[model samples]
Target: MRMTEAELAQYKRDGYIVFRGLFSPSEIAILRNETARLSAIEADTVIRERTGGVRSIFRVHEADGATRSAAFGALVRTPRVLEPTRQALGTGEVYVYHTKINTKPAIEGTVWMWHQDYGSWQRDGCPRPDMGTFALMLTDSSEMNGALYVVPGSHKRGRVEPYYDESTSYKFWAVPKRDVIEVLKQSPAPVPIVGPAGTCVLFHCNLLHASGHNLSAEDRWHIYISFNACANAPKFTEKSRPDWVVSRNTKPLPIGPDVLNSGTEAELVRATSPN
Candidate 1:
């Protein structure tokens, strides 16, 4: 669905927005079924399982079964979410950079760290702001299962530095923490975007958001998908992110694919920042 003018304004000002009914009930039903099937057969098998040992997070990129989930692909390309993304980011064609399934079991899992997405992508050669992604809940999400926490206005702030030590506590990477807090000091109260299964939250690449751990018994399943608009998009280097990428680039640059990777816009914004 096209975003309302108010929603669009909020998106532009806050750098993100949460739409209540992202997926149809039938669609969500199918997703839950598929996820259950995947979970039952591959619970201990797919991707990164509880690295914290506390039981708050499960990274699903380590296994092929997780990599190729059909439900995930459908959600990423769904026009409801994609169209708004295109209008916000602007691109003829968009690419889903990667997909992440975060399963927060009720009694286990650690809290998601507080940091910025851009802290990592400050690499020499990588697509910066093509698009950053947020996940859609496949199951009801809450503090019991460590729902996501976001710093509402941080997306419009100055560049975020990497978290050297606590960085890894977030996703794949992060920058320093002191720098982030300094920027966040002027922000509003930390607000956790609330929603049920089938809801999608989209944020800007540099939006400073973080999620906490689930302290309850219910499982919180969220699927995150990264994407980028088709043009002005950094050319795909030979070796890049496996999720959404170019098979080939017509207008090539000096960098080769081995390193011109694709990641959330936060990475690109931080890395490419003139600062």
Candidate 2:
């Protein structure tokens, strides 16, 4: 689906724009099933919370063989996601920097500290902030279930200084609390990105955002596909993370049809394979 002129303008101003029910219920159901299967696998890519719950699954776009989910492999190529991402980055040629599924299990889920994604990516050697993420909700997200909170227009500040934070269950480069407070004073109040299953939010990489702990009985699950301009591929750095986390593959992805409707697992893999 193509983005409207208004949607593009909103993204430029707000640093994010939400598309309600962007994916249909059937598609989201497929993703939810795939998420459960991936979370149960014991692998290095499956990062766990301090409580041993699955925190996130990285490089989901690379799943193949018996582990592959045709639905998810197709998601990476789906124009509904890729087209707008191309528009946001102002480049028709783009590659997947990485893809991840973040899961906050009921009651036991942990908090993600306030930070700009670019804060971590910059250290990975990305030269510019010309990147965006398409975060699709696999389950309904609400204030009680740890919905993401984003400071509108915060991306205009560009990359804010970040401190390495280990205070949370998951370690990440976080914006200092003092800096966050100062930013809040100048920008609008942090808005909770609340929405139903299948809703999607495309956000700027430099946007300041965070999420609280899940206080309700329901789980919170969201899959993120981060895209960068092919010309903006990162340079190797001493601090560069693993390929799964920081991909070295800068190949521009070829858009695929809605494979979810017609392809088998093996066909889908071949159709979208980075190789």
| Root-mean-square deviation of every model | 10.1, 1.8
Q: Could you give candidate 1's per-residue lDDT for residues 1-275 as a string of tens digits?
A: 67788988998888888988767666676656656655554443344434532221233322233334434444444557567776677654665544556666566655666666555443413445556665788887775567887778777774565645543333444535676567567888777776777777888777777666667777777777655554534444555543222212222111111111232334423332223
Q: How accurate is candidate 2 locally (lDDT)?
A: 0.87
Task: List, in order, the clash count of every candidate structure.
Answer: 30, 0
lDDT of 1 at 9: 91
lDDT of 2 by residue, 1-275 (tens): 77899999999999999999888787787788889998888877888888899888888886543334667778989999999999999999999898889899999888899999999888888899989999999999999999999999999999998999997666889999999999999999999999899889999999999999999998899999999898888887776798887877788887887765544667776667655
Model 2 reaches what TM-score against the true structure? 0.95
Best by lDDT: 2
Cα displacement (Å) at residue 259, model 1: 36
Task: Give the top-scoring candidate (TM-score).
Answer: 2
